[model samples]
Target chain A: MAVITVRQAISDALREEMERDENVFILGEEVGVWGGTYAVTRGFYDQFGEKRVRDTPIAESAIIGAAIGAAMTGLRPVAELMTINFAFSAMDHIVNEAPKLRYMFGGQFKVPMVIRAVGGGGRQLGATHSQTPDAVFAHFPGLKVVAPGTPEDAKGLLKAAIRSDDPVLFIEHATLYQWRGEVPEGDYVVPIGKSKVQRPGDAVTVVSYSKGLQLTMQAADALAKEGINIEVVDLRSLRPLDMDPVIESFKKTNRAVIVEEGWRSYGVGAEVAARLYEEAFDYIDAPIKRVAQKEVPLPYNRTLEQMALPQVADIIKAVKEVL
Target chain B: MKKEEYLELYRQMVLIRRTEERAAELYQQGKIGGFLHLYIGQEAVSTGLVAARQPQDRMITAYRDHGVAINVGLTAKEVMSELLGKATGMSKGKGGSMHMASVEKNFWGGHAIVGAHLPIAAGLALGDQYRGGDGVTICMFGDGATNIGYFHEGLNLSKVWDLPVLWVCENNQYGMGTAVERASAVSEIRQKAEGYGIPNERIEGMDVLEVKKAAEKALAYIREGNGPYFLEIMTYRFRGHSMGDPERYRESEEVDCWQKEDPIGVLHRWIVENKKATEEELKQIIADVEQEVEEAVEFAENSPEPAPEELFADIYAEEV
Candidate 1:
């Protein structure tokens, strides 16, 4: 198996889907001839031509809205917002129209659409350009929010999202784009709403996703040297959250620490912690601890930005608190 | 326009006006529930556009869409039953007045959320063009919706893709309670199309003939592969925005003045001026429409609500 980065895996998934079905098309700012903001769609324009590979204007709302419209009327559209922070402009279409159409109209219509945006903070892009908005989307009932932490996971879950009949918000971490991992070079799909245990242990459980998953792994490795074996759970999907693995892991570990890059207030980690207490209260040996970014606007200064987001040390601290 | 065509437009507009008047009565009597946005004075816009559309063409509009449904061949009975939340309604009583839809009629929908349906309208046109079908979509919304971001996005994309769609604005002078001048930065609704470089025109919406003429030009432009067209129909709402509206925003004289330009009255004058028919024939048509509307109300009032067990049925295509 060839090693591939998360960026390549996503582009490969898109290319494979486009090759498999003529109905699949990609549209976004700087997506076609300009490659992409992250160059994830390099060489896609020449192969797909102008029809299937489109370069849209800097209108995030229009890009997603058009994709939703196209998806409803037969095409399977994969709309790319340059960054997750920019997706707020299109929140109405994604949250209100795309997700609710199937239920509001009594299942007479379905918006088979996927909105792909790069999220998570580490690039010193400041507050406006750097944010993890998955929890905000997760608050909605009809949407399916997927955050894949690895290249293989990205490839597999994206295929699943494109094939599904519901609207899927496929969020990728900007910092994880260059991280490499072995990916299967064939047809595969990782079902949505499933969480995977990356590292198994019995002392404590560290749950996270995207960049948070990487930090959790680092923290897990550091904690192991101290003889405190920790289990790391990468929450692949957030909306239809797969809490079974988390609860079972908690039952064995008896302690848990959830991590997220979004702000602490009403964040995904908070939700995960709440669910842990609700399901496995008796199994827990201690109170659940959370590691999230500070609840303040991210500063553009390097030192301040780094301090605002959760690091390996932060996860380590949270793990120690839970243990 | 020919006398026959003018009379047809008048007939459709009169039917909608009378039907909505009866609907107001139903709401007062507690037969219909939910927030109902009546398409009273704006009847000419729907009738005019539907008259110019091809049989295979599609149509979509905002919540003020009872007129479009009726013009697209849904009987007053079906519409009335839907409003009454009867099981025999278009959406099996699941969708209320603000969310009516019919796939078979090619009417697309009665979407809420201001200008949300514009993109869907573009998609319908895109699909028709891609499939080599000689059809187009007429997307309708209120004057207040022109200020929305989706309106510009949808219009620009329609122009960029050269999609076959007629974006019709039924400017009834108010967007809910906010007047056109209050909410918009630039209040000339027709000029809103300039940013997209699409052809646009402002028409007298009170007259059915004028609306039909403008719609005919717009429809021909789209049909000829010239891309999307926009029309701003200057009209007024004879009733409040909804059933519970206090209507303290506008003066009583304003409503009375617009009522005089009622689409039906305008049509009747034209019919009399052209000597198309005696006054008795027009009166008979009105009586027949009223009878049809009454039967529809009876059917809706007697119809059953959805079964209690079916609440969980249509949540998904199948069980999640």
Candidate 2:
């Protein structure tokens, strides 16, 4: 067993895929010699040359649009957009072109592309860069939105996104890049649109994703100290959400709290909460509780920003309120 | 010039114009549904661009694509059937006017989003060069699409990659009723090519011969591995932007001014004056084209609507 950061896990996935397939290439701003803004592609340029480890202009729409074009003809392109906030520029190509091409053309063409963008709001990056847009992507049927929590799942799901015949929106948390876990050093792929149970308990179920999963685990730990056991379920895939594990956990616990760092209204938490009520309403002992970010623009001050987003204490408070 | 060749271009332009007119009529009837962008007067561009390319080459264009689809070997019957939402249509009635694609005919697609297909065409060119195939890509778009950010992005990539792509901009003077002058700084569409270091020329799009010659020159450069070239065909749209558009942007005199330079009329005049064909012979060809279009309409009307279950079928391909 070996410990690795989420950043290293992504690097391993890209390295393994690039070795596995000659067509798999990486293109983004500062992705090559700069090793990536977050070091996700460290030493990749030396290994893959300039063609595969391509450094592009600071044009998000061009980067994604070119990847869509390249992916359609041939080649499995993993395009990194620095941050998810920048994806607004490429939304037309991503939402209109990549997803609809296969269906619009009656399955004559498929856009095998992966758009990897850093997301979440914890580093005081402020309102512009600190959005969690899981709901926006999850609303689209053709796109598969994945946000993995642990290093192992990140590497596995990313490889899966690279190999998918359909376009996949793979989101990673910028703050979680340096966080570490044990990931096997070999060829492996995790199927998309599936969730995993991070920690199991019988008192209350906690559903979260990306950095939210980390907060859920910490809350589970803190709740364990108070003898209020909680099961933390990491929802790796937001679209085509696997309700089996989520429903099974809800049945075991009969009480649930969804933790998300996005705004409270019409967020991914709202979807999860609605789905839980629809599927396991009869099995629940109390109403579904949701812990999400405050409704205002995220403040830049460290203490205030920390308070704005959901934390372990927030999850604990929500759990106690529901109990 | 041979009478058949001259007549063919005239018939093609006529067919495109008539089909778009009929499409607009159907849009009013609410039969052929969803954004119906017509390519009424810009027929010479599609006919000439397709005529310039060989079978080995590929082509793709923006939403106003009924003309290009018909010119590039898709039967008018197939196009009309698609418009009618019939099961036997191209794309099995899934793609209407905007998303028509025939992979077998090397017709890549009819992308709805403006300037989106430019990079796709460039990539196809790259694939052709890599495979050592004697193929080039003809990417067509409206003048309004020229101002899009993807236009610059695609042109720059094509230049850097030295891809075999000919970016043809149909400068019809309006992008959905916003005049080219209102949206763009330098309304000379050819100058947009200079920004990406790609050579470009302006062609009188009302003449098929002129568009054909310009396309040949652009294709020659692309085929010779000189990277991408640009051709701006100054054209016009006789009708409103779509079926329901009020068309309050331009004056009636502007439409009358462009009608005098109609591509079909120019081709017909050339056929008669150059002694390529007699008046009687030209009328016979026109009659033949009209009959073909009428048959296409009948074929579309008689075709069956796609099954409700088919809505779920074309989302993904399943290997047998």
- The most accurate candidate by DockQ is 1
**Top lDDT hit:** 1
* Regions of candidate 2 where Cα sits further than 4 Å from its true position: B1-7, B119-134, B275-281, B316-320
Model 2's chain A TM-score stands at: 0.98
The Cα error of candidate 2 at residue A288, in Å, is 0.7
With a 3 Å backbone cut-off (N, CA, C), the pairs that clash in candidate 1 are none
Quote the lDDT for B247 in model 1.
96
Off by over 4 Å in 1: B1-11, B92-94, B129-132, B269-284, B307-319
Interface DockQ of each model? 0.51, 0.49
Residue A37 miss distance in model 2 (angstroms): 1.0
Which digits, one per residue and each the tens of the lDDT, describe model 1 over residues B1-320?
A: 56666667767887898889999999999988988889888887788788888887888899988999898888888889889888878776777898777777788788888987887788778767766677888899998889988898889888988889899888888888999999988788888898789889888988877777788778877898989988888988888899999999999998998899888888898888889877988888888899999999999889899788657665444234
For model 2, residues B1-320, the per-residue Cα lDDT tens digits are 56577778887887887777776677778778888888888888899989888898788998888988888878888988999888878888888878888888888899887787776676677557655677888899888888788888788877877878888889899989899899998899889899889998988898999898889888887788788889988999888888778988989998999999888888888878888888898787667777877888789889999889987774533220
TM-score of 2: 0.95
